[model samples]
Target chain A: MNFDNMRFSKEHEWVEFEKSSEVVTIGITDFAAGELGDIVFVELPEVGREVKNKEPVGAIEAVKTVADLFAPLSGVVKEVNTQLEDNPGLVNQSPYKEGWFLRLQMTDRSELDELMSHDDYSRITGTE
Target chain B: MSEPKKTPLYDVHQSLGGKMVEFAGFLMPVAYGSIIDEHNAVRERVGVFDVSHMGQFVVTGTDAREFVNRMITNDCSKLLPGNLQYTVMCREDGTVVDDLLVYVISEDRIILVVNAANIEKDYEHLTSRKRKNVEVSDVSEEYALVAVQGPRTREVIAACPFFGQVADRLQKLPYYNGITFYHRGAEVLVSRTGYTGELGFEVFVPAELAVALWDQIVVAGEDCGLAVIGLGARDTLRFEAAYCLYGHELDDHTSPLEAGLSWVVKLKKPSFCGAEALRKEKAKGSKRVLIGLAVSGRNIARQGYTVLRDGREVGRVTSGAFAPTLHKSLCMALVDRACSAGDGQFAVWVRDKEVPAKPTSLPFYKSRAK
Candidate 1:
């Protein structure tokens, strides 16, 4: 996937911002998806819930283990991908796009500036 | 602790994109691809598991049959030659040492397949309790075990060219039975036994030819949708079948009676290790019992999760998972017998929240193994 427009978090989440808007889309990166393995269920934060930066907002249930889904940015959970409720496999199949976890209305846009660029993210993931 | 051991197929697994993890003092594959995919492959078509990490022992002597019959909880006399029986060895106090498969080769010879983690413990236990006429030898490193399991296991086994004429014998082999076949001038034992609740077969081949046999089976089962399974799926499959894993359900502190393995405890046998304790427990009834839980939702009630009744801690989850075949979250818990009374509703502490759960029948997914 072309991740040029996305900002990556150290926690392996990706955030895409809407041009000139405070709204941003967040999802786990491909590396995280591969590590999670066969996601059976996704517990997304409820809409309108306040989320803190780097705090666990929900959980991702895999076949053998469970992983916490951390909030990449501080915001109100504007929307959650309801599609994940019934089909969590999408997170593994399309980690970057359709697998997006939540739409956040950012309370602090400065958090996005602290996120890593595509190159930095790749370096951390050792994909570079 | 000593460094973990590696199996003959370690390199092959790495080449196949397997995710390796340390399990029971061995570097084993946890998943080749997706664990769910591997799990479904076994339930629907066929799947192969490298169970080489499991420990194997050979017992032979004039009194081997009599000796073994007195060691385990199952009535080994009922197991005819070429048959296998699932049983547990316990301490004199009735606490489990390990759960194993006893393969009856003959009246005076037997093969004991034990858990990988309990190799040394089981070996020592058997030898310490041995009689002068019986001999016990650990042959764990001599064989590579592969389990081909699922509804399509028969077709896949028949397609393997390496089996040659033995494939025909394996095809007709009844469940819980094994056959000794000659391959490359060595004795190869194929048994119709598996932990998965499915029609399956476990083949024990010489260690040196493990990779070759694995390759042949892969090629042979290419069109049958056979995937290379790993320990992750193996545990899930066994959990769905309600099979007791050594450290999970059956442990050093757990009794077979409390583990819901009373069927294997042949108290009728005059004397055996743990016979007295088991008989006493059977008479007084067990303090706690293993029960299946139909967890309400996605949040898995993992091992160590507290099972509560009316906000009181009753027991803990032994094993839990999202069963692929049943498409629901299920768990096996050892709860106080009082929890079974009145309404079936209970709660499982999944982290901070108490997820609603209720007692359910075991073998969560009815096994098709028979």
Candidate 2:
């Protein structure tokens, strides 16, 4: 998937915005998935719940450790990927596409400015 | 902080892409590539582990057998020359000091393999009780331990020419037995015992020759799909077999009987350290007992999680994980004996919520080997 327009948080979450609908799709970055190893379970946020920027929305558990998933921006959770309930390995197999965690209706459009761009994210993650 | 110690196989682990972590005051590999994959490799094929961080003590002298027998819970008098016995040493209060393996090399000479974290403490405990004509020496720094485990373990070792004449003896070695052989003019002890619940072998080699032996075994077993496993998979493998880890299952405060290791405790032995207390506890019964739990969800119930019965905290989890081979989240907890006697219904607090769990039999997974 092209990460050209997607913005990334330092915690390794990516937010792809749809300007026409004021909605954004969020998921963990490839680097995050690689470091996490095999994902056995993912606890996603409930749809329609309010979320604030940088707040923990859910958790992702691997065989060895557990890591929290943080919201990239302030919004109302519009949808959660229910497929993860039975198949959490999707997060490790395809973190950018099929493994997208949730969709949020953006409450503050300016929050995207605070996130890093594709080039910046890649540089920070040392994935370039 | 001072730098952690490194094993002789440290360079080999790094070159194999093992992710190193600090454990028991040593820089050790937690995983090579993926823990699940490494776990499967051991179950289906064969795998090698660098467990050199474990401590070894050599006890010898005229009174060695009698002295050693009195120190542990198991009957050392029953062990033959090549026999290896799993036993626990306890405080006078019946609580465990550490669980260790005793290799009965001879009537006068014995080797005790102990946990890395408890080396100094265990050595001190052994030396504190002065015995007539007994000599105890800590030989941990002089040796390295490599565990080659799985159904295909014998084939892998036999293929390696570096093992020399001992490679042939590996085929005839029975479980819980060992033999000392010469490797590079140094004495190496090969034992048919493992923690992974598989037909396996643990080789004790001189620290200087450890790297060479590891490389040759890896090369010999390459075609048979032997991967270099780390401590992460090692823990899961042992947990599936319901093996007790030192700090988690058995501790300085927890009795071995409560840890479901009563079979190792011998009450008829005239007298031993903690025997009187253990006998009393046996007669009165224990208040808390270790039981296995199967959580209803994928979220793991980690160590220190509170176990609840009827909305009240009854116990705490000691070790828990998502068992990769079993395809379920399993945990071992020390709960109130009364709570464990019910219809197997209980709950474990994960994060903030109480996840529904049920008591299951110990050893969530059993190996196919005889």
**The best candidate in terms of DockQ:** 1
Tell me the tens digit of each residue's lDDT in model 2 across B1-370.
Answer: 4788999999999999989999988899999988988999999999999999999999999999899999999999989988999999998899999999999998899999999989999999999984779999999989999999998998898899977687777788988999988876899899999899888999999999999989998999988999999999999999999999998988899999999999999989988999999999999998899989999889999888999987888899989989989999999999888766756459999997999998889999888871
**For residues A28-109, could you state the per-residue lDDT of candidate 2 as single tens digits?**
9889988888888999999999999999989999887889989999999999999999889898888988999999999999
Model 2 lDDT on a 0 to 1 scale: 0.91
Interface RMSD values, listed in order for every candidate: 0.9, 0.9
Span of 10 residues, lowest total lDDT, candidate 1 chain B: B337-346
Q: Which residue runs does candidate 2 get wrong by more than 4 Å?
A: A19-21, A118-128
Worst 10 residues of 2 chain B by lDDT: B336-345
**lDDT at position B6, candidate 1:** 90
TM-score of each: 0.97, 0.96
Candidate 2: interface RMSD in Å?
0.9
**Candidate 2: lDDT of B14?**
94
Q: lDDT tens digits, residues A1-128, model 1? A: 57777999998999998669999999999999998899999998889999999999989988878988899999999999999999999999999888989999999999999999989999999988
Report the alpha-carbon TM-score of model 2 versus the true structure.
0.96
**Two-chain DockQ for each candidate model:** 0.85, 0.85
For candidate 2, what is the DockQ-based docking class?
Answer: high
C-alpha positional error of residue B45 in candidate 2 after TM-score superposition, expressed in Å: 0.8
